[model samples]
Target: MSNATNPTAEDAPPTTDEESVSVGTWLTVFGGVLGAFIAVLNIHITNASLKDIQGALSATLEEGSFISTAYLTAEVVIIPVTGWLAMVFGLRPYMLFNTVVFALTTLLCASAWSLESMLVFRTLAGLAGGTLIPLSFMLILTLLPPSKQAIGMGMFALTATQAPSIGPTLGGYLTEAFGWQSVFYLQIVPTGIMFLILFQGLKKTKPQLELLKNGDWFGILSMAVGLGAMIIVLEEGNRKDWLESDFILNGTLLAVTCLITFVVIELKRKDPFINLRLLARRNFLLSNLVGIILGLGLYGSVFIMPMFLAQIHGFNAMQIGLVMMWIGLPQLIVVPIVLRLMPHIDIRILLAFGAFIFGLSCLLNIHMTADYGHDHLIWPNIIRGLGMPFIMVPLNVIATAGLDKEDVGSASGLFNVLRNLGGAVGIAVLATFLSLRQQYHSSHIVENVSAYNPFTMERLQGFANHFGNLGADPILAQEQALRAIDAIARRESFIMAYNDCFYFMGAAFIVSLGFIALMKKPG
Candidate 1:
């Protein structure tokens, strides 16, 4: 009963002959990609709105953080399974159902009366929405001929990369103007249109019910438990102080046990949920390694830049978006150029240059200071924009290009999962580094600011005099002056810590260059 043998018609992709490429094909791609776009975009659109959501629901900030965490947890867990789930449900019905569900969840999230309800809706949104990214990636393979794939992937990357860049800006404006509910509302129209377009042609893609009986339920359970537990740990680890906390300790143990169990179960299972067989291939393995690093850079920076802008630069979400746009818009020119070069050049060279450029850009930010703002970010971010497509498009092409048609689903799913997981891990690392480094920096700076030093004495006296002149009591003046100097020192320490983080982040990009080197260009 395992799908390893006796492949069914349902295992094959639905195809139209060369003679009659119908409008339905276009509509199908359009529907699927648009759904994918909105789904990916949703990951971040609600990002800038979380504070408002917390205020509206009267939930503590910790509870509000789960809105994104739950969504991402569901998303990462569901991504690898989507390929098989789609085939089991029939791609058309599966796609259509998820689109409707995702759209509905947006409405529910918008209307949620409490944090608990919002978490449920957001998780559902992730469950239904995460499938679209890898689903659409494989669909492009099925729907388009080899010649058109680069272009299809180009557009997909553009949407995936561009949407998150501006998500905060869009969320900011909507939350500022109409309230946080508007962020959820923002995607409804796009999702609705996606559903309507797919509703017509998707029925033609038949379901394979036999897959239901042969399904790897054990594998599924293991994956869900493993990934869900792991993501929760990563997302909350810093806040909970890592393995020291009971919650984090248990989560870590569960994650390790389940993931190890999942891998063993998968290796031995005859039609595994995720198709571990693909990882044996050299190109696929190398490409996925690159994917993880790229995700760390892309998602990690996306997380950090906004924190830098909103927390330090005093920018609103919209203003942060304005700067983030520099990282995305250049892709418009870069993608087309990368596509053109793919046939003529070796992909490894492109990847090396791209990775090097991105890493160098990270190094450039090591110069960040309290005064750095939009003007300081422009060229480095643009360089990052140009570097991204070269790395992503080539890596994606290399990953799936060598894969067999049937393997594309599993490979795509795995590729996306690693990338999403990378993002989560990257953010956790960034957050932890900032928190610990901030403390270390503050303490180290304070150690040198003692009034025993001439500079310290002068600075301390100046603050006390300024406060005394402003009508503070003598005792209160000294206290206020001390607090004021401490605040300045703390800010300076934070800036330096961020500078340190950039150097660490840049190291990730440099490491990726080795993976790119190891990937053999598909002959």
Candidate 2:
């Protein structure tokens, strides 16, 4: 057997004689990963074109923002419960139904008549897309043995981790070349292909009718209300002014109350909607802790970099995408190499090295200046591309190392839920941090700009003179210079603030080096 298909030494790599994993198994795994890709890709793609979509729908920025927000809110709510859902409706039938519904919703989004209609279509689309993520994760573990699990997971992680990176770039080009609706339409070809592949490949298995018959309705409702409210608060918290907005304050309260109740109910229920008991295992908890931290770094960094370019350096969606590709394109090279090396190396060593490199990459970005461009980001990004697969792929495989086959599906769903929620929290907290720091830095810079300082007076005079030289009236030139000074001050403050944020992100992963040590090696 090829190294890629072989299991770990500890796993006593399964033989083809014992239970062969055929080519078709891997093929179906690929199909499922593609579904996961499109699900997440939609989140970033729609986000990239949200402004244009707003103009098309004639909605305000806040209303248009819900197009992406609603989809994700639905997605987070659905991810953890999907394992039970897959059990309720057999995996193959459930997946096929979701693919069809997701495709249909994409079409609805393309033809949406108004903002409200788009929100409905997008939310429904999320309901379907959310299933694809955990479903893909569940399929890989059940289909492949530990020895060969790396190959399957490497492929899945590549898509799940890298697809978000590619979405903004892909969406920008598609929307620019075609139109805003093209972002929704672009999924049609991929969805059609995914449907045909899974439909032909997956055999129908009888579902546990009992699981469906005794479905935990209360668990589902509380999970939805809790996860849904939390996602909304994260998505809109900054806009609503967090604690100051009654809507945000009340939503936060409800989210906390419902989520705590969800844990309590799931723990007491004999057959719960989510398998909360799985978290009691040490390896599972430790690995998930790492996953949550990785999620913050992964999604949080993806968000902050493009924002820096777009906000500070004036890069457009396409340009930002091009710059962001440095972080993603290298993963293609790294993931395959890591797959080959994984079985030979101590998985812990690989995880530690990856976490180290990943943290280094974040710290490297702390050197950003006002003039830093695409060239400035390459090495830091290259380090990140290489480091991430080390963490993401290994974590997935090693976390489930000791679980029974039946427990894998439930574990995968809850694992993914943490990462998704972590990403949401990371982005929200980072955004808030950026805003608060910018205000602080801007005020501090202004404090040093008084007339008592010769450098400050000289700089202000130079700006006025420069504007005056550009053929503006003296009064207009004076106003323009003052505005220019303020703008420059704010921009510098942002750069400093972003630098601090990168350092904080790096520290999280650096801390995860300790997390790597906490895990007991797979037996």
The per-model lDDT (C-alpha) reads 0.83, 0.85
Angstrom error at residue 297, model 2: 1.0
- In model 2, where do residues sit more than 4 Å from their true spots? 1-19
Clashes of each: 0, 3
RMSD of candidate 2 to the truth, in angstroms, is: 4.5
Best by lDDT: 2
**Which ranges of candidate 1 are over 4 A from the true structure?**
1-24
lDDT of 1 at 374: 97
TM-score of each predicted structure versus truth: 0.95, 0.95
Steric clash pairs (candidate 1): none
Candidate 2, residues 1-523, lDDT tens digits: the string is 0001111111212236424776767777788889998998899988889989999899998888788889999998888877777776677788899999999999999999999999999999999999999888877776676677788889888876787788889888888899989999989899999888888767766665666567788888998999999999999999888999999999999999999989898888876777788888888988989988988998999889989999998888899889877778888888888888887998888999999999999999897999899888878988898898998888887888877756766787789889898899999999999999889998999999788989888998999999999999999998998898888888999999999889989999989989889888887
Instruction: Please give the TM-score that candidate 2 achieves against the real structure.
Output: 0.95
